[model samples]
Target: MKDMVTPTMPVFEDMLAAHDRIAPHIHRTPVLTSAYLNGLSGAELFFKCENFQKAGAFKVRGACNAVFGLDNETARRGVATHSSGNHALSLSYAAGRRGIPCHVVMPRTAPQAKKDAVRGYGGLITECEPSTSSREAVFAEVQAATGAEFVHPYDDPRVIAGQGTCSRELIEQTGGLDAVIAPIGGGGMVSGCCLTLSRLGPGTLIFAAEPEQADDACRSLRAGRIIADDAPETVADGLKVPLKDNTWHFVSRHVTDILTASEQEIVEAMRLAWQRMKIVIEPSSAVALAAILKNPEIFRGKRVGVIVTGGNVDLDRLPWSAG
Candidate 1:
């Protein structure tokens, strides 16, 4: 409830500072390519392989910045957050690095591998029903009981600043790009990309990719306001959350467009990445690739950067396994 108030927007400078602040703790995840995939899409696609990041997702960058950027006194209370999965594990990993307690509220339906990863990083997990209201209610209780500093998975300024570092690295690594595409869950990564690319790579167009099953971001963009969705069924579980106020600010202002892909297309893209690029990417990350492949005319002959947001998958619950 407190976080619902639109927080002050983090500027480009904050992203720069966060990039430096979190650089040592996190990986400058590599930019990868698949020549075969590029030929298929008719674009020179550079995949920022955040799946190989410390917590197996790009969420680590934001979590690390939020944890480490805190004052010593504040951080002593440790950190608390609610996530579908990756952010929980990433926040836990960051807190563990800071030698502090981490509390997490995760959806009951979240993949077991992500739950295990959170525990592996020493996060105390509290399960919540897989819905927005439930996650918020459970997280409120966890925050109150633990007296923890809340690090929202995607809404906070520090987290956005941290996420911006991803694009900063992408721009530096690839020199220049015609466009950048990132999945829009709560819009943290795309907002970060918007923030960073607006300042550091102004010429580059920013696109937000979303699952058609949970196309709230796309709808919000078209409606020119935030449109909250309760629960949407999609294999891209990480993308079920809707955009918050802070994230909406960046998304509405800087993002060029929001594109969506069907669940089948998302799965196909995920498998294609694994098969062609030899990289494991979660379904959420596949959303961006799906968008590109589905709309080749928009990306043809352009040098595009796609944020491969995460790689954490439950081996027993692979998308194709559900028959």
Candidate 2:
């Protein structure tokens, strides 16, 4: 595990700045409530539907901020990134809107829907072996070939700040929430969420839901060190990254507790969401909801917020059988 970068109240201010910068560029996804879920969980819940956000996921928020944050010279040259899905779609679309090049290193297992979106947005896609080493190598090759500035999938402060917008809006929408739960992958989303909730909803508990299969973040947080290797495989491909220095830092400081969910639990939660609420969410996104549903006592009688990270699953090969 690596040492965590401590978080502070200043991150809250940076979150505000990020909100102002990207608000015009991204959608203010509606906050929806479910009478059924409230009744079922014995808790009031607000769902931030980033699945309804542009590019069909919250990735666009951070990607747009990263691209737009680039200076004039850099934006003209374009940006490069490596992602399994949503983030690639986001960076490609963002770069397209700016009329610059986007070079993406995509894992072989990346959903077809996401790959097509990248191509449609005119991003140059480079296929990789679907492992950390391959992704890093491909991204390096693409960067060397094109001289495009690297825009990491997560770990960038701009990306973290932009991702934090979800929490800012969540707090503003609900006024006061007892707690907020978001799935932790590379920590961009959780880092951002903690930054805002720490200030506006200081009393609010911040919980990160993670898959037990890919539980590096969970292990690292408990050990108070960063884990950068042996990222165990998970069906939730989106939550595959090892702990990052910046994100682990924020998690150690602001996040209250990291919860673990089984792959079966995540799939069950996804099925429940599609059937009960008619909202399609990725397995990674389902971890947050799984935490809420499978463990009612934790959120019972409290106002809880959940982030619907994405809905861009491949129709032909969804992680779980819909039938």
Best candidate according to lDDT: 1
Give the per-residue lDDT of model 2 (tens digit) for 187-268. Answer: 8889888777777888999999988888888888888899755757877888888767677768999898888899898988
Q: List candidate 2 stretches off by more than 4 Å.
A: 1-10, 107-113, 128-134, 229-231
Best by TM-score: 1
Model 1 residue runs over 4 Å out of place are 4-6, 107-112, 128-137
TM-score of each model, in listed order = 0.95, 0.91
Please list all clashing residue pairs in model 2, or write none if there are none.
1-226, 2-226, 5-249
Error of 1 at 129 (Å): 5.5
lDDT (Cα, tens digit) per residue for candidate 1, span 1-323: 55532378899999999988888899888899888999999999999999999989999999999999989998898889876478888899999999999998889897777677789999988999987789888988887887889888888999999999999999999999999999999999998998888888899999989999999999999999999887799999999998988899999999999999999999999999999999999999999999999999999999999999999887777898798
Q: TM-score for model 2?
A: 0.91
